[model samples]
Target: MEFHEPVMVREVLSVLRPGPLSRVVDGTLGTAGHALEFARLIGSQGILVGLDRDPAMLAIGARRLNEAKGKDGPRLHLVARPYEEICEVLQDAGMTEGVDAILLDLGVNSLQLENPERGFAFSKEGPLDGRFNTEAQATTMADLVNNASERELADWLRDYADERLARPIARRIAARRALAPLRTTTELAELVREAYPPAQRFGRIHPATRTFQALRIAVNDEMGSVERGLKACMSALAPGGVLASISFHSIEDRITKRIFQGATDAKPDPSNPYSATTTEGLEFELPFRRPIACTAEEAESNPRARSAKLRAIRRMEVTS
Candidate 1:
């Protein structure tokens, strides 16, 4: 199936400005949506490396590139791996010096959500595995619902997704699993709905929304990899390289916002609240004062664009 239109494409191109000899990386590389655009801008003179942990997505990306006249386009390298391990990917590609741009598109891609077998959405009835990489050998949503204690599950929901009804939901999940292990997304959603009060049960969003988000993140250990991936992207950039990310929810956006602002805005705690520490003239700068948002038109066309917020930082240029 064709994936949804990528979020904030215009803004991304304007900020990144891929050109000849540019070395760019799409860390998430979900179906090569952004990578395809980068390939066009970079032309045959540049390089665009696509990386995703999912082998299935990688295959799709390769096919997309091939159909897009891969031979005459910017040289493409698609790697099957997560962004956190980008250092290895770059080293293996012999790009040790660095790259010109890097992108980490955080949150669920349309491909996973639309495909029920991956089990990333509660709207469908599928196995409760929410791993980004099916081969990741990590904890699955089913494992959490079946094995974790109510307290453990509740704490996870609260801490991971900030679910306010974590206790009641976790209690219900535990009780339901005791009867029969929750195996499908529909089952979990039903359990969460039952846990909610009647009034809130039929609210605007599915009661299981936050629970699924929390489980997906925990299953993939996304939060744990954010810091590492951010640092890796920064370190992998050549002088004056652009590093960007599009985060869907507040949790990911907050992490990116704080990290981007902190580099140029961090200082001593009390005495210098506005003081920002720079590192050898290499500290990054925020090109846009605020995160770039999707246009109203794009949002109307692609509802997924409504939640996307793009943030970027540019590595400083060397000086005498």
Candidate 2:
């Protein structure tokens, strides 16, 4: 299976600037595309920790990294765990000093999206199973679609995907599932398509796109994971260390931006507005004022890069 081509590698490398002996973490190591370059930059004496929830991805990433690392390369540590558990992973690896750099390339990778059996693509025919870690997750897309109430379905569709036709779609799903459970991607897609008004049915994008995205997000609790993972990474950064995140959609981007902004921006105490004391300490600084977007050339070459946004922050050096 073809893993995702790491998006905006040049931009990520430029911001991260990992050096020889620097400890780094690729929190979303999808087949080691970015981790391979990091291993090269950090050199033989460096420590590289790669984390992924999917056991399949961890296995593939380990194999690829092993092939590239050879006899002289970074000490590799591949963990089958979510990025939210970064601190615990580091502690387990005996790196309480923290990591020099961390990277989180959020959202679904091409490995899961392109594979029909993964049930991430609305256009494909597959089982309604969208769990990233099938062995761990008890609930699946099938379970959500077949068991969730109309209100629950509508709420998830609206909140997760920003689907405007959430109510109509939920109504349709409720009506259909009353007769038989929705069991396939195509079945759910068609139901969502039918929910749209005839004129809006065949727009530039498929009617089911938002619905599918919402379902996948709900099935995997993707937003919650991203939020927790971002916080964990920021806390796990060593002094003068850098953290970079690549988000595929607006919601994910917003969560990253919020966490990074909170760390970098200081707020005044509400009780005493004139006081110099601030509620938050300036522990981190934004490397760039604005998030970086993929270049035109990159967007043209890789369609997935169109919506990709890269943001970076650096932990400030502490002085006595």
TM-score of each: 0.92, 0.93
List model 1 lDDT by residue over 1-320, tens digit each. Answer: 47746788888888888887899999988888888888888888888899988888888887887689555688888888989889899999999988999988887778888888998998879999988877766778899889988898898799878899999898888778888998999989888888888998998899888999888887887876776687778778888999999988777787777667766674533443223432333567889878888999999988888988889989878766
TM-score of 1: 0.92
lDDT tens per residue, model 2, 1-320: 47778899999999999889999999998788999999989999999999999888889889999999987789999999999999999999999998899999988888888888989888789999988899999999999999999999999999988899899899999999999999999999888888888998899899998888999999989998987888788889998999999998788988777777766656633443222221145388888968999999999999899999999888889989
All predictions: root-mean-square deviation over Cα? Answer: 2.6, 3.2
Query: Considering every candidate listed, which one attains the maximal lDDT?
Result: 2
Off by over 4 Å in 1: 266-281
Candidate 2 lands at a TM-score of: 0.93
lDDT of each: 0.83, 0.88
Runs with alpha carbons beyond 4 Å of true place in candidate 2:
199-204, 268-282
